[model samples]
Target: MNIRGKLIIIGGAVDKGSFTETDLDKNVSNNLNFFEAGILRRVLVEAKHQEKSRIEVITTASKIPREIGPEYIKALNYLGATNVDVLHIERREQATDPEVLERLKAADVVMFTGGDQLRLTSILGGSLFHDILLDKYQNEDFIYAGTSAGAAAASNNMIYQGSSHEALLKGEVKITSGLGLIDGVIIDTHFVQRGRIGRLFQSVVGNPRTLGIGLGEDTGLLITNNSRMEAIGSGLVILVDGRQIKDTNLTEIELGQPISVNNFAVHVLSKFDTYDLKTHKMHIQSSQYI
Candidate 1:
């Protein structure tokens, strides 16, 4: 299926804001500042209507929707986004609300804030809202963007549970079905800051056919035409390729035991780097400072 839409999978920022000015700046040295930096602004610019686009920020994954939702609105509003609103769909019933469906239908970009990826998959999966989102992403020039846990749930396969420390142990990294927007890929956020490389490694080694994407803080990928991804923001994007793995003990290793995988290919991508999803290729351009 040829997709006509785009995906912006962000590495997340300081989204657990308690409604303070420090909410977005608490981890500025390690987090993506959507307004001052490029991720959120890029989301607006990618929209067909720019700041006028009807953007819906989904807070289904956030426990404190009251805090996270308005903060996003405040940030986008600062960027001159006129029609942005927060959709605090905490209950499953809200997934089928006519008003929610209407707003979704009229939206140019849907942004998913960080929280619990499992909460998002459990509540919205198979709902009419999810149906429309999938259809729009496949048929229209729509945008589906997510950050942190939202980024993890953007793919068909999601990693909901896994400790960064024990991720390499067999049976440690848990996997589940996601929103199914993109196939054959798994996305992990706060890669560098959280040291989640082991989690991603265990994930891809278990399912070598799937591509593992580790997004660093203050970084993201602007995936256009559904296949070409341009690394955006100010950090690194790690591409873990398990397609060439020569051997792995994941299939035979006992629970809590270490697993081994050989021939795994990894790529470290920085800003201005491009990767072809369809061909599994990475293209790095000359450094701007060089």
Candidate 2:
């Protein structure tokens, strides 16, 4: 698949506090603050249309849309974004609203906030708004960004319900169709913080052909042209590649029984590390400034 736009998949807990404060600072230099130098800041710069960027923030995934909406607007505004509008489409009926579509049409960057992944797909699936969003993602010079639940819903296959501790058991992980912005991949957020590696592993094993991407909080994966991904942020990004698996007991086990597999490859990457999805290989480099 050839994707023309860029994807900024964040791992949730992006700085929404004081831009000048150092509370959220992880690996950032003293000269660079967290809010102005965090993952979201990198996303804004990568959009490359910041000066004239008309950002449309979709808060449908958030349970507290009103609260999350303004927070993003404030953060973006602090980052020098002049025109950031919050599209509070909470219902399926609101997704096809003319005013909503109009704003989406003119947006240079479309951001989805964190909440429930199911809410986003259920509300916008098969709607005119979704079709337009997918079209823009494939053909326009657009930037598609999502954090947490938003990030999990960006792939063709999404893990809706699952517990990491019970992930090794058959049928423990539940998956459904996502927005299909990117193909052959499944994404999970707040990975390390939430101890979600087992669930991500289950996802990759079930759909062995699909790559699994686990993102840590405050970290992000910048996917360009649907092929290469570059890690950005203070946390780590874990990749589970099951293409080389030699054996598995998935078929023989019952729905609740544990599964066994061998030869599954795992890769851990940090900031500035790059991975080629097509080749299933990674290139790691040490941080230059650190």
Candidate 3:
């Protein structure tokens, strides 16, 4: 099935104008606020729902919904998205609320914030809200944007918990069913900054058919048709392709033992780099940089 909607999967730590003078460094001081230049702003502009597009910000993944929800609202509003609403559906019952569903259906864009991916699936899974999300994604032109845990929850195979140190060891990474907005893929957030390449590599090794995307902080992937993805933001994204794996010791290794794999292709992409999910090929157009 061809995906009709667009997805903006972002890494965590998006700047929100809350950076203090002490936090300003060479890497951050030169960048615009999250609402101004990063993935968030890109999503708002790309949505193109209308002038002043209506956006539904789902803060289900966040433990501190109250804090995160308002931050997003303020940022969106700053970016001229005046019709932004926060859907703090923390419980299963709220996920089925008529008002909540109405808000979701009417919105031009829906965004998920960073937090616990498990909470998002647990609360909204099998609910009418989730069904609507899936339906809209396949049939409508709505925009779905997520960051951190939100990005991780966009795939069928979700990486809930895993430490970078133990990523190479057998059975170190935990995989669970996600919302399945984007299939045949696994997503890991805060990639480069947190050194999560190992975990992403493990995920791809376990599910060779599924592509692994490791999103770095302040970075994002603009996914369309569920097949093509374009890198956005200043940071990098790591793509791990295990389809050509020639050999591996994963099956023979016991729990806690380090495993090895051969012919695992890894690609590091920056802004403007594009990837084909089905072909597993990257296209770096010179015009994109010009």
Candidate 4:
């Protein structure tokens, strides 16, 4: 059965959304306005493509406010999503409600807000809501959108615990399980700013079965129906293909001598660029590069 209809993995939406500090306190990032604007544009455009007048924003990360807050609801509304249901499915929240499951079954677009990736998986894993999403994504007209931590969960393997600096050092790479929406790829958000190339590279070296993609802040990778991907947003998308690697001299690497590997190819994609996962090649719509 077909599982994922469409998926949009966003790096970091700092401007338009909220962030939780390492200590779990709520801290608003600086670029929420811009983040909201860019995300709204993407949502509206996607909805227009499906010819749907409205989209559904399922907010499962945050607490249950008296009602859907204006900031989030307004963002969806401006993007043409007439109906926004903020489903609070935090770890402390109850398991998937039957009513919410039915609503999710009716949704054409499912958006996961940014927060903590760990919390998101913990709450939704093996729950009825997660099962319903899997079923609908396989059989219905649904598009999944995830920003930041939500984006991290969109992949098969998530980097929940690690910084760029630590990853660059020898024997210091860490990763955790993810939602596995898109196979053959390990996704990392807030890429360039966090200097996550090392961690991504380590993931590839550890598992040559998947490609490593690092998306910069405010950027995204749109995975289409045919498994072809396109880069969007303001920054660049980094693709690391390690399938051809012959040897990874990781065991003997020092702290800062530049980790070495064989046949590890890297590519940078911007807007209008398309990447084919099956063939592992990237190209502009009309231009070619090899």
lDDT of 3 by residue, 1-290 (tens): 87789999998887755434476554543544555567777887788664388898899999899888987786677667878889899899998899999998888899999999999999998899999999998898888899999999998889999899999999999999999898888999999988998898889988788888999998999999998999998899998988899988989989999989999988888888899887888987665565
User: Over 4 Å off in model 4, which ranges?
Assistant: 1-4, 14-39, 48-54, 62-69, 251-259, 286-290
- TM-score of model 4 (CA atoms): 0.82
Clashing pairs in 3: none
Shift of residue 193 alpha carbon in model 3, Å: 0.8
Report the number of the highest-lDDT candidate.
1
Off by over 4 Å in 1: 14-19, 22-37, 287-290
What candidate 3 gets wrong by more than 4 Å, as runs, is 19-36, 287-290
lDDT tens digits, residue span 43-92, model 1? 88899899999999999999988888887887787778999999889999
TM-score head-to-head 3 vs 4, winner: 3
Q: Superposing every Cα of model 4 onto the true structure, what RMSD results?
A: 5.6
Candidates in order: C-alpha RMSD to true structure: 3.3, 3.6, 3.2, 5.6
Give the TM-score (vs. native) of candidate 1: 0.92
Worst 10 residues of 1 by lDDT: 25-34
Cα lDDT tens digits for candidate 2, 1-290: 57888999999987555334557554334424566657768777877587468898899899999877887886777667888889899899988999889899899899999999999999998898999999999998899999998899999999899988898889999999999999999999999999999898889988789999999998989999999999988899999999999999988889999989898889999988999888876888774665
After the best TM-score superposition of candidate 4, give how far the Cα of residue 8 lies from its true spot, in angstroms. 0.7
Query: How do the predictions measure up, each by TM-score?
Result: 0.92, 0.92, 0.92, 0.82
Report the Cα lDDT for residue 181, model 2: 94
**Per-residue alpha-carbon lDDT of candidate 4 for residues 73-163, written as tens digits (9 for 90 to 100):** 6555544566665655644345567767777777777777676787777778778877777676666656788877788888767877766
